[model samples]
Target: MTNADKKILKRLKKEDKKALTELYDSYWEILFLSSYNILKEREVCEEIIQDVFIDLWHNRAKLQIKISLKAYLYACTRYKVFAQIRKQKAIKVELFDDLKKRFQYTNPETKMMDKELVYQIEKTISTLPKKCRIVYKLSRNRQMSHKEIAEKLSISTKTVENHIGNALRVLKKSLGYTFSILFL
Candidate 1:
């Protein structure tokens, strides 16, 4: 945060309403757009951002931020968006029986297709350079965050991101038709 942001934060800690409004006015739109990119639902994204601001107000005095307010806000919004996705996935799983009745498909075919894709994906991964393969496996198999992979590999976060990006590009090229389906 800049000195001006620090001043606003200090005022917010003192429970100043103007500071709260200032923070909200400055951040709301960017935060809303970030959430919308993930959730793709305007109303839900709006509510999530509003909830974040309200939570900020409620815990203003106790807010401990190691990064800038922008980083903090973005991280919070991302987490909430991912949480919402998890909830939606759970609900979808619960509704699977109803959904299955509405569609006609054989599970064995789906399972076979999945297994074939997995085998092809593994083959593609095995062809990557050693560092890229390691980073990709740590990210996809272990479910580690980029920062965690950086820390584990004793590399910078940007390096980790680049490796992951390069790995994805290679996989997309190698898999061709299969790549788009994996992402979807």
Candidate 2:
């Protein structure tokens, strides 16, 4: 850590507004640029940078940064940008999937069957191994895409797909012939 950053962090830990302002002034532009480079959204980048500082201020007393303040700020910006990307991807996927499902099963009986299928799938997911269950929940319940689940859980997309496959195999075995409807 630089001498200046160390001093600033020390004052920040003590709730010094001047230190917080200094930190913001020193890092905000760099952080914003870093995020903008990835997300390419002006307002989103601005909000992300603001969130980084807000988080820093809120957790100032417990800050345990092991890197330089600049690196830490950059890391935070990158993480926020990735999270925003994942959120956007998930929302888009969810919307598209919802539209498809809505059009596919409009009748009352099909709707009831849909509900039961979802319940059975969820029940089966609950019986999976910890990682597999989490992956399945994030993919099915949260409507996150495989890529989003992988990024959020810090795993490979292939790993996410594998986990989903494992969960599905379990579901198929447990639900028997009824599970075959999902493929159709």
Q: lDDT (CA) for every model shown? A: 0.68, 0.68
What would the per-residue lDDT of candidate 2 be over residues 26-135, giving only the tens digit for each residue? 87876665555555679998999898888878878867654456555655655566568668874554434444254224444334434554555567778899999999
What is candidate 2's local distance difference test score?
0.68
Q: What lDDT tens digits, residue by residue, belong to model 1 across residues 71-168?
A: 55654555576567767774554433432222112234333433445565688889989999999999988879999999999999999999888888
In terms of lDDT, model 1 sits at 0.68
Q: Mark the 10 consecutive residues where model 2 has the least summed lDDT.
A: 175-184
